[model samples]
Target: MPFVICLLFSWFLLPIDSAPAVASDPLLICWNNQVKPLQNRFVQLSYQEQRNELEHSAEPWQQTPYQASGTIWVNATNFRQIDTLRNTTRNRTSFTKTQADTQTLLVKHGDDKLTSVSRAMLDEHPLTAARYSPIRLIEYAYQHHLRPDSASSTNQATCYRTTINQTVISLFIRRADGLLDRATLLAPDDMLGDVLTTLTYQDYAAVGPSQQPTRVIVDKVNGKVRDQVRLTQSIVTDQAPTLLDTPADYRLDMTPTPVATARSEKYSDHVYFVTLPHTDDRVMLVEFTDFVLVAEAPLNSENGELIIQQAHQLIPDKPIRYFVFGHHHPHYLGGVRPFVHKGATILCSPGNDDYVTYLVQAPHRLKPDSLAMAPKPLKLEAVGARKTITDGQFSMDIYHIGSQSAHTSDYLIYYFPSEQLLFQDDLVWIPKTGKPTRISTRQTGLYRAIQQLGIPVRTVIQSWPVADMGVKTEIPFAELAASVDSK
Candidate 1:
């Protein structure tokens, strides 16, 4: 009777469970090629779209360059293709350009991370790895073990998984298809939710030994299908994907990082960081609950590792523990390996194991480190649309956000109850005098979700510039919604 009452009461207001979590069963993928399973079972499964123009080279494309034309689903909603071309330079400057419908605005992305957007129906995705994460959910090729028939397959083949996490995911490509078509992510019983991005390959063609898709289309957030993919060109490279070098001009915005001066003061429970201009991309550290739970460690372990070491200096012997992930971005989560090394279980949202694991281990960057490879195991705590973490005096909650897969799927903006400190990320940056900028559907959607859920938030912390939190002056939520013209 006491245990039951305590459980209910805990949910009523107090802090929930605090035990080391467990590792979920790994996703199992087995194909009895002889079984030939029904294709319907596969969601958004992409095969090689066929084309009559490109020919199969007797040899696999070592550094082959070819062009393709087709349409892509701008989103799961209403999206159509204009035309497109791609220039593949050994995957070095692999460039792709697309024209929208009948209008202008060409969309192009060079290398992998060096992307440009000129009027595509979208901005960033709530889950940058929504598609990629699930792709990891399905296994693929590993290392340089090329399939015997890779060229004839035209980049179409089978593969397997070598790792999984918040960033770079790697798998072994078998039978030829480099991209995933048949794989299964071992998802926990709790993490299966809605499918965010869906891509359907209509047909395929042999482009220099690779089975390249000629008519590949995708589904938008609303579930609409596109017809053609004006693949301007296609290029195969022996080298790895091009990556953007870290900027030297960048410095860790420590306003929220707890400088030596502010370290001794105990204003709140745990400090929060909001990169929303007002403080110039600096983070605002909010001391919550007589303890601290650091959220989103992406500034990389190298830069912020010192923050943890200094926590002892500031809080004396409180024993720093608990780290939370804001959303699942490879770059950000790549920096999280440091925490994993510290034996901290990741606290995340439900329905995101597949995607989050992929980011935690997907392969996108060239240089590989132990951290980049998703070292130690992860401990996860999945929360509901409304869940809180309170140590009596200080309290914070994790709220649900939808239609916001641009940035991430396993996302939760931290909300402090007593201090009224609300930590919101990628949703709205406190404008200069508060003006909104070109935003994302996920960001805009999150703003609506917050108001609809009625989260009793006061001082909002935007954890990027590292120092962007302040006392509640006015209702910034309403103002932010109006800026996005949210309905």
Candidate 2:
């Protein structure tokens, strides 16, 4: 889970007291003063919001700015939110909807398919919860008990601090009107180090019986603007009986099918391909005389644990000694922490030691995983232009797909000369139906690298997108060469 989502769920577990022990507590007094006016202002509040955000993607340092527009409907008991994001660069438009009550939460993504999970699930997986909105935050605090720990006065605002499950949440109220001016959360992030997220509310406008902020600016402690939201419209109306209920026509599933088992296919006596259930991600296992080497840890720690179990089942007794990273992307490296916990050496392309170290060492205290419970020092090794690992009986060579490629600079591929096989990630995508209509620069890069290195690669295996070209994981090298030569 992302740190922000985990932090939000941690807030749900806080013990809510009806009132402060001491009525004279200044922080409590301020909190009450701020929340009292909006207690019973409206039965149903709805608003259309436009969001501009700098979202973090595969590369933590490279933030992508996107624009999304959505509408939110909230009542005393239930709330619904819908957001549509149109990515011009990718020529794709995605839609997401989240509706929740005390009992259940229903989420719809892109299509009519809806997933319904119990509200309790949010405690562990908060990504299913509604997106962060100032209105939603105010509604939650007003309905539930917010215990303020301390209060400090700034020149322009009074800040009240609340600590829940070791996560610090501070609200800054304007001294003049007692309206909320800003909110800040201090938490630990695996990629950004310690993150201090601040949301500043501005341009208040009257809505029914209360005032709503027309503009909200989200910023990080690093002075980067993360998101800006504008309230395009707002209205209050009488509550309807089933406004937030799941639609009858929508197909709903109770819970996500658990990926408890992995499917493995043996390519050779010493080599196997393993794939997790319900995902297109895969990993390769190479067995040696004493130990095993696993390539690519996809998804999260749970998947990583499954990979470890599958390896033990396939090649029993020998411990997994080395784990090779396909790239620095989150989907590829998200499971690397589990390998560290298992005492395996992490092999990655050059210039990723600090990143791999951060993944293993960052604080997972909010929701402790295996590494957090039993900490381990990162055993990291960098693969330069080319590095080989062998035990005489079995050998695997790691090669860097040079920076000149259109893809990432740190991308690495594995090869076995004896078997004439090559393994890579994100370099080739064989369409389910087309025959080399056009070739991408990424494929050209891989072809050039193979030609320059003079390795005889008869077959290529991909570690991602599990199903393509008739459910087979291997693609002939001639097919790729033909595609690169076409057009």
Candidate 3:
């Protein structure tokens, strides 16, 4: 009787224990498929990238191509990438390096200036996170516990959708090999609204136990191909002993220092031309009896803050009442937020309302600036074809450069009638040697605008090349005409 009852119990337990092996979670399956292959290997990848100029240039619709080459080294605990970008059309070359350990991220850009920030900041900023390698992305996702909300399959691949903070990321895994085929990230932009950036990987090749894409194409949802990266080499090896070491000559700073030093030159009693420390960008500050007006907030917020500090030092008693930027280009308008935080009215060119509005209101929780820490409503005013700010005794005219200008349609130039000084940005680039090889349509456009506006101007001040050894910030109008009239 005991043997028969035991046999009956054993038969029922067999069915319960083997209930079809509960289908594995799709998210975990995909994650393991991608990560397990690269678990113990160190990947060294070298690639060359070709990018379109239209995405970053002042000249709209100009698709000039720039080339860049980079190498990335990734292991379990460390990541390092070095990129050299060359713009042959502009005759410029710059080098950048990004490296991260367990606790800190070190970034070196233009002029070999290294800045160290918290590694955790990458978690808060999606655009920065998107620049990482696929191996690094997998590590980041795993570390952050990013779980997929949904998984869907198509004929060719299965895609998993996940959200990291506010950024929406969709990862597509090829059905054949279960490798990452593409990744699309939707992140907010201050100027372009919500930008959909897609990275598609192709030509999967094996490096030791891991597989890497030999070609990667980056595209935007606006039908613009941002860049195409061709992988030249990939290998699995031990990390170099000095792979993450900073060069002894590189300037290292723990805090964000956009401007090393600022110098202000008094162009006149009311107008002072402030030159930024290390770059060719400049700002103009005009003082009134009761308040001050600043023109051309260039670069990032740190650059703007330095300019503000100089403005306060020059005019101690008055608040900054107005902030005017040249156009919508990032080099010109990027620093507008600092002015908005000071409760200044922003005077910008038409069609830039949406862009400027987004700049001030955009969330900066990752690294909060003065404006982000203390919220304020954006006080914006549009400058049409022409507008003038005057205290009756002094007048400065803001004129739109119009569509005839080859640079940007909504460009604006500031003219001071009393000082007989005209201030413009990127309209004319005069060489430091006061000579002309050839004339751009942009230079002639300025002459034509001056002729049509019929404003008397004796001197022209450029909002660039604040001081280039021999270059003068204020050039006589004749020098501009000579360049325009020259062969």
Candidate 4:
């Protein structure tokens, strides 16, 4: 049946139709007949011509005659991991980059004496490999997209593709010129949690005859920053080996220290808070049950990994029984891979589970350490307006956030019956002493939800904490909202 339809559609397209000739400068015409064949997909011809023209240009790829390698070192200042509850300052650290076998090997040493996260990740999880150079994005965009019409649906397209280590990658190009725009890497849930890594192009010049961003900044979209180095320049050369021939050992180094202790804040005997470290330069903690019911997966995979560990430790005597995906974002839910690996039932909102399956779960991306981690089919239970999880005496009511923010869809907030603690990410922020610059309507809606839901929130645990717990009483949700409206 499918083949017959395609044959008919092709037959309908092969014959040309008569039409009046039209002409203009940009020369865009009805070409309705010429273009109708493309209505099923997006087509931009001039783009292909431009690209083919560039691929044939003379560009430098690599510098040969690999010389005896020497190392250049630098001491990083003001470096330490931020804690959800506090900041950790360790000894001074130093980093060096050395060329070996035509590749760069980075060595990090410091007085604070912390293990390098990049080194640890590579060593522990051998499966997840460092992603390819951002340059491939241009090539990927050209090959992967069939046409603009096909790319038009907001939710219809699979956002990315998978790598050898089971990582899903989204490669993008400019909408108009079709120039390589950016490349994004999402970690598999097994290691970190689905988290986004964005590499933006910058500082373009003709590398040979093609334009490319020499200084690229790869970081999380929300400023969960990673590195900021001038790309310096790109060398395109015929000497450049076929991408398949490129050595597999080259790696991108991460500056974060290896996280050693991920502890849960025991709120009540029944409730606990697990802090997740993120590159976004913010602190978020996941709240989960003892036997693994519900996950507070808030941010990216870094946060996702911590929540997974919390679930495991919360009740080491038992495995995680249930996984609660707190919100939906291409970055946030990608980390659920770990829960899928743990074989736990997942609790999520209506559209959320489908989003997870299509965007994150279907990808099953892994990191450097675990090559075998794959996406596991989950037993999903949907939550409507409210859902409750408790142990006879103690309970938490998880409510869907009612706000006009696309920041988090399928967003949920949890309230503790005895602790008077309420959680709603981005709903409100506690202002630190000096008058804050302003607030937002999302913050205002949080205030409305608090009153409307009648949640006796003594402590507001926002996705991004407004103030440290010690100074939380000074939080002004209403003032923050008014500030936004006033602006």
Highest-scoring model, TM-score: 2
TM-score of 3: 0.64
Q: What is the C-alpha lDDT of each candidate?
A: 0.39, 0.67, 0.69, 0.41
Q: Residues 195-307, candidate 1: write the lDDT tens digits.
A: 12234433444333234344434443213222233332433322221123324542223234333222223335466332322222323343444555666544344433544
Best by lDDT: 3
Ranked candidates (TM-score, high to low): 2, 3, 4, 1
In candidate 4, position 373 carries an lDDT of 52
Off by over 4 Å in 3: 1-32, 35-133, 136-259, 468-471
Model 3, residue 24: distance off in Å is 8.8
lDDT by residue for model 3 (1-487), tens: 0012222223223321111112253334444654556666667888788877555445434476789898877754567778899987878988887776555566779665466554335453333433435665655555554433222457777655555554556667676666777777765443333446788878877776766778887886444547788886788776633434655654424465354578888878888988776667788999888889999876567778888999999999899999998776766787788898999999977777876786676555434578878988999999898998987788889998866567777888999887788998766767678466668787789888897889888998878656564455667898878878774
Cα RMSD to native, each candidate? 18.0, 5.4, 12.2, 18.1
- Count clashing residue pairs per candidate: 127, 0, 0, 34
lDDT of 3 at 344: 95
Checking candidate 2 for backbone clashes, the offending pairs are none
Query: Which digits, one per residue and each the tens of the lDDT, describe model 2 over residues 1-487?
Result: 1234454445535543445324554334444543344453332333334433334233434455556777765543455677777665565778887766555567778667566554344332221222333444444444444544332457777555554334456666676765778776665554333456677788877656556667777776434546667765666555433434566654434575665568998999789998875557778999999999999877567778889989999999999999998887755777787889999999988888877886677666555678878988889898999999999878889998755456777888899999999998777866756575557787888888999889999999887777643433568999888878885
Question: Best to worst by lDDT, what's the order?
Answer: 3, 2, 4, 1
